[model samples]
Target: MSSKIQVLVQPGTIIIIQNNNYKVRLNMIYGKVRVLRNSHRAFKCIPWLLILFASTSTYAAFTDSLTVGNAKALGLGHAVTADPPGIDSIHFNPAGLTRLKGRQMHIKGVYGLFETNYDLGGYGEYQQGLIDELLEYQYPGSNGVIPPEAEAYFYDEALNSKSSVEGPTVMLPGGMIDIPFAGGVMGGASYSPPGSNMTFATNVYAPMMSGYNRAEDDPGRFFQERGAFTLLTYFSPSVGIEISDELQVGFALNFSYAGMGLELPAREPHLLLWQYGHPWFQDNFCNDDGTPTGTPDLNLCHIVSPYISYGDLRIEADQALVMSYNFGLLWSPEPWITFGLSYNSAVKNDLDGDWEFPIDPFFNQVLLDNMNGSLWPSFQALTGALGLPLPGVAETEAQGKGGKVNVQYELPQHASAGISIQITPKWKYNFDVKWTEWSVFSDIQINFDRDIAFLMLGSIADKLLYRGQNGIEPNGVRYQLNLQDVTYWGMGTEYQYNDKLAFRLGYENRPSAVPSETPNAFIPINDGILYSVGIAYEFESENTLDFSIGYMNSKSHYPPCSADLGNGCNPNNVAYGPYQGQDLRSEVSFLLFEVLYSRYF
Candidate 1:
């Protein structure tokens, strides 16, 4: 009789199978199992194996803790209204620049350290054929479960994984030479890190199969790491005119440059058993007499060699240059009251660069020869699955890799309004509202030559549709984007005890650019309360120094994860996951230190 039997076992039950020539053993829990024998081999049925073995996890979303405004002045919650001092005043209220008592030159420098600790984990089933077919369609030139690409795309999607820990010690040493001419002229330059550092890790594991639960103390695994960095510098020149003692007007030209680099270390292990149709079994076949079987089944046996590769992809763009202009007005309506307004034009950046993706000479010769051509569409689709829009492509065009992709980024226009009042000789109050048109950042595009391999992936056509829907006209054969917008509200207070010492405090709340419904790990929507404190000391001379610190305790209440069916018969009765029930907390702290030196000319 055929040795086919289905049995339901309770959790923690050890089942033993025996045949005339063979024996097998397994631990079963809360499920039905089927055992079958054909010729001399046996197979067991474990339906939810993928769900049991898969890993589900979470990580912090990507959010910049560093605000673009002056880090020093920002530390005080921007409450420096009653007494506007130096060039740093442009950050708080450009109108405040009118309060400069004399022609002066000011220079300032800053340094900072940032860190984050992340703890995340989860379990989810793998849809065997779906992911494979999707990958094959997306990356046509790749073969048999491209583990590197798989892990890259998986983590990119699951983790929306960007770096949480960005250690940046930046210098904003700009010397503003202010002159009292028609109005006034001030020019200076500053340097800072534009975005969070990019650090990533990829892990892959083989699927479990019959007889060989492959369930040893530890299963096989592979890991890879990649790191990227960027530096940004800006130059500004401005002119202000004093219309009256109480009102002043000013204008400034803005220019900036950005540089970026990336490094990736790729590694993978060859598996002897995984290549063959039977993966979970031991490699060496032995006879009952404990002797090696000279004639091994070559069809069911193979060898995998350890392989490592490093790829350095570098791109430099002189086109990283950006330029804009700002206008400002300040008014002192009464002895105790002052108001300021500033408008900053958008800075447009069309970054053109030479890009080189150099493959490793040792282990990637095959990839080098075969992987030439356009892979952007596949890369875009992979990134899309992770909820991040690719750099220069629209959501629709993301599926097609063929087109002119240009690397571009834009800084939006901004409007600021602020008011300061001296309620008492020792106490001052301030309020400011700023609007940033971040929505103008719509999309980034990368232009590339049309390679047939890339064209076959439907990259160009998808992008064309996306452009049409967005009402974007293709320029120089490239696509466009429409990013989200942002608004900020701020309030601050200053208490003075003496001529040399003062205490400052402030608060700011900004809404998230991305809505909670489409929360992606790539860009986190951070809406939080910022608390700040700072101390300013003035020397007997014409110089001063300031120190400040701030903290942000943020929380996001995301909808629960999908329900687990095992605990209930119907969808409504399904067991809900832990992360699904409530809020996820994320915390960030900013320690800012700066020194400013001023001298009248």
Candidate 2:
């Protein structure tokens, strides 16, 4: 037996061990696993790949995920790892803080628009076709119409969209905050005692903020009706030291608050559900399985459809402290060019929260009244012997807990390297390449302290319908994202128009980190282009003001039944809930503006 554990590092790439001493590659698509004689070669290739990432494309910023909160960094498309911005250097590059002298303060403000639109399609087409075909085979006259239950499940209700008009959610040390008009407020300061080689600074800001509210009538509500995720580095203390004139290094520790809230209606739109919805299924299997003792006409699968929601789930999770750190190095080998590198440690947020999963009243009643037979002996007990309240008897009042719920979430590691080049006295440009370990999201698991109505449903239809292949275990559930590690390039330029004013231009090509196979509107932004411009004004008293504006746009297209594993585009497994058939296309755009005031005292 091979001692090596199979770890999935990248998509389509896996390392396998055999013969106790050999490593090989596993080809999952083939019947047998493929092996290489020189498995050590795979280990040797890792370093080379990182070196090659200098020119590839990676993940998105802003509303997509990691948002560069510094106005200067935003203006430069976040290529400022080599030329970090003022006090915000505590995040971009700690070493850059060493460049600050005397006492300084920077107050910043930001406003942005996050917009998303989706083209919903063939909601119940796939499942309906199956129903019709089955009906035709069983009874030709039944082929004329779509069932009422099917419409309820796949209703093309009012579509929802996100706009800048809504408020923004912010997580702070004390509590969650809400701001008006898609904007944020923050400030930071730094100090370097006279003739000292070290500089110290502190800043509070949100590195990543995501959330939105939509109408309840939206059919897409099944996937994401409303949700918010905020990571606020409320307390960050950092220091930088000048080891020498040519070399500088710095490190910082951050204490943050993370909060996530989501309200999603749940449903099963899998193709298998359509099979059970057939009349033949109910006629043959809906009654009592043992002989002659006939029972009521218990309808089991009639109410089950790809379009009908079974329940609604709302989660509120927060972590008091999310600990993380950053390290950076700056080396100036030449007068015109400087090389910088920085690393951000990964963080795991074990959040504490509560959850409620309430089954729909009508759907609840359907099950309470009609479910019967040996196929569901356990359910029979709940409706009869065990004495569950009558269907729709205000099930909303139910709350039984074994313990508090917790969600384990990860913030992946980040490594960035860049160079600042002074082409001439007035023209300077910066280029950076970054790698983010987004693959940590290959699977995101949720653990529950108590059993809920939604989790309870998985036991009955584990494989053929919904609740994943094995159904969600009563104690835990997992969602597989299968994300990939991303490597991307960013660049920016600053032209000193004169001593008092400078013009900046930046461009970054951010590729989607989420696998194409699982792409959907819930996450929204996809492969995109970021374009930005900014200006800096210097006063006679050495005070400076900077302002910038940037925009990012992305879109994706998924055809019917094209995704592997019957998820996302396939609409066959309800992997993304309501994102079934209609040539799904998603467009997301971000328009943002920022202002920063830096004063030297």
Candidate 3:
């Protein structure tokens, strides 16, 4: 009997035990698990090993929909409902699989380029001038200008500082393939199986790849920075069956994985000082002591505020996985006309992962500091005199914790219909209408497995009526996107010049799901008009190459407003207060290119 065991560790770390008794223990960090053992029961630990490996895989950011697709469909702005004839049909209208006559294979790849610009000077003008003035006046000596030390303290003490304020370019890749077994026809004494003329297919596509990195000093940092990736890729396996010569149907199962991360300001600086009874801020004309004074000090009254300094609370979920499905049908009642419909089910995901956040060293040591080394000692002596322990002040340390954080997100369900008409022997036209149920994405909630370090900040607000000014109760940390349902319209034309050459062109109007009043810096998406063109060339028998490109441009602006949460833009009603009343404008565009090779044998 052989008793040698092999163990693989992450980061290329490995352990091998020839004949030693070892017990294994596993610990989790950054969504990865590490196994430590000292018992030789390797056979019994195999299942545990599998679980550990599975738990280590993590995913991030995902949205309601993807904008890129296969070259042919994308060339038609994805309006292939009634003209589906290849692997792309698996997603558009799988029933079109019956259009294939022989052995079929297709390999496709797509690349996407994205750009976003935000005119956030309105938000920055307030915070930047405040900070500069604070440094020059209170901590002076830079000749009436912001000192280099002040600038360095705000920008140099964080992650992704350089790109935190701007959106970055993103790349997306996608492909699909189908295999069919030419089973005989059904009925008429043949009595063939249900799917005798069926085809099987698989696809991998990145439908949503969008995010940004905002500079730490960006006034919007209190709202969001190091923006969440919201990136999602779908793996689908499907089957298409011809119910009859004139009608066909298909079904597909979709498995989606997402990688997500987000960072935002967690506490108010002014509130922190007030809660700790700091001397720099006098409350109700009283000094650090509770005694009321007739002459209230005004010199240092305006120095401390939520906008003075910054602290970050970041959340990350990797390899978050979920499942959904799609069904499609196509029918041709006449020789020159075809109709198609497809429905994609909603996907619900509960992201389980870890979170890391350290108190801001700059905020703690500078803005909230009492400006005296003995302040803590003095508070401790006073509390001890009253027979009570001193209250805890904000301590600076990275609170890295490993546990399941539930991020409940749902991809909206969609339904679309399309018609294709053969106007001439060489010319064909197509049109489509689609609807998305985006109301499911009304808001996003982040639930931690254990009490987060910043919960106390919100709890203090509720206890001290700090949130009363905003006219809301503390619900902890969350975001209110308040999105709306959207509809899309598309049109395309294809010209079959000859058996060896073909041309295609298309246009589509896709509206934004989020309202302008609730604009978000994380996703710079807007109502876009897509223009596309493509060509196909057949150089050999039943073999062809298809290439195409599409471009979309859109813009969105959020002016200052006052209204209820569900009706209009109201930042005070949301968790991140710093973004309130700040005018935000964005210009966004997307360019997609694809190439596909298909062969029939």
Candidate 4:
């Protein structure tokens, strides 16, 4: 018999080939793997040769820790902790409602706007053909030496172009309505309740809305192929009591709901490298001394394929939903001087929903070609003689069901303090500071109803050992994430030109919670500063109309590898496998707008 071993393959079936040269096994549906036996008959196998691999919302951490929800809040840089009082105060500090007289109602509309872009340098190119050509020439042939023309072509035409990804403007809308009832005797009767100044209020609003979608060809696809979005809304009923003219306390019952959608690349970069960069494959192409020859082995280039290209594939979760509380205090020692504080409790959001995984065309074609190639004729003839089932190549659909997916994330709790001072008769100055326990946002857990053992050979072997048998061990895929804490501060001033008009200006700063060593392309955030302006017009009816606008242009953070930061940047610190050396250069900006209407009844 020829030195080469013959083999037959079947869809969704396994075949064992035992020969003097090597023992090869096939697993049709999950992924591809080949096994070889040594002299001692001990099989050397790389686990999970091939399996389903994809990414989903691994980095949707605590970006929502702080938000400017209303016009007065935005205009004042959300520093309302101690200064002016409005319906939006219910969010900043419910106790502030004690300052309102008579029955009152407040309505406000808010929008979070974003426009962003990123470039990882390797956009719009695939390294597969280049890798294949390099590997083929490593076979001690003249072609093994890449010609100067070929080397030039690889850098000039293949790598020199810009493939930046830009997203259109995205707008997230939310609104709040509040009704506060000031408690006192309805008529001018002599009877006075001890706690007559108590006020009860209820408000409903969307607290946070975040989403982004990237092109499939984007190089960062290995980390976040597409993107994700989340929207959270809450209904709060509260009571505020003015114990005396100088002090007030507030309590609110918080009921919240969250919905999320996410999509990611199919195969994680590391997994692809694990499957293709086996030591055996490396030894075959490199020189006997393990040093690169003058021609250099091209198979080494296979390592880069998983890093630079996304293969235009995706897996997505359609929806997931969860529920969480907030407490407030406001103290006014004098008419011009005030202090405020608030604490929001942490909440865990568990999102469960449908998911989708699209099959990769390149992987499918490769599997088909291997099964139907030149060796199939002899392999089929032998299997037929041995009365084995005829081998057939199974065609995978472009996509498959991703069963129910459940992912859990923690929304961090935040505490804030503020002070407001009337510097002059017409100018009111405010200062606020906030801190979030983002440490609690450490990790995200992703679990699926179905066992993803189909991707790992170890799980497959265990499944086979107990298939149709009782007492089988269970195995599934799980992923996690870790994050850090953040701080924010704001300063604002409101000028009352007259009873009919008021002007507002403020500034705030928030720093990134993501560590540089653990950078994620999805969250792509940094130190941010927001400059805001607003105006309030009082109608003859004594009702007020307010509008505010906020603009934020964040500083760019180029990984040390990209910026020549004194601290040397190692691609492996940020990414794994082939994607390790890729540097990320990102710029992010935001625009916030709000409108509020208040009426005293």
| Candidate with best TM-score | 2
Question: What tens digits encode model 1's per-residue C-alpha lDDT throughout 355-466?
Answer: 4434345323322222332565576577567543343323222222222234554556777777888899999888877777655544434444332221222223234333
Ranking by lDDT: 2, 3, 4, 1
CA lDDT, every model vs. true structure: 0.37, 0.59, 0.49, 0.48
Tally clashes: model 3. Answer: 30
Model 2, range 85-121, lDDT digits (tens) per residue?
A: 8888888889999999977767677777766665655
Top candidate by lDDT: 2
Q: What is the TM-score of each candidate against the true structure?
A: 0.55, 0.78, 0.66, 0.66
Candidate 2, lDDT over the whole model: 0.59
Clashing pairs in 2: 121-582, 153-307, 153-308, 154-307
Q: For candidate 3, lDDT tens digit of each residue in 1-601?
A: 2222222222211112111333222110101000000011111111111111111101121222233346788677677888884765656776766666444455555555655455543433433443455555546575546456544433322221222235432211111101121000100000112335876555444444444444556643443444333333334567788888789898877665655555545433222222233333345555455433554322233323343433445556644357778789989899899999988787676665655554456544442333233465576476457443333342223233334566666667888899999999899999999888776754445566554333423333333333323211112233334567778888899999998999999888877665555444434445678889999889868777888888877665555332121011222233232333345555656676777777653
Residue 451's lDDT within candidate 1 is 29
Model 3 compared with the native: what TM-score?
A: 0.66
Estimate the TM-score for candidate 2.
Answer: 0.78
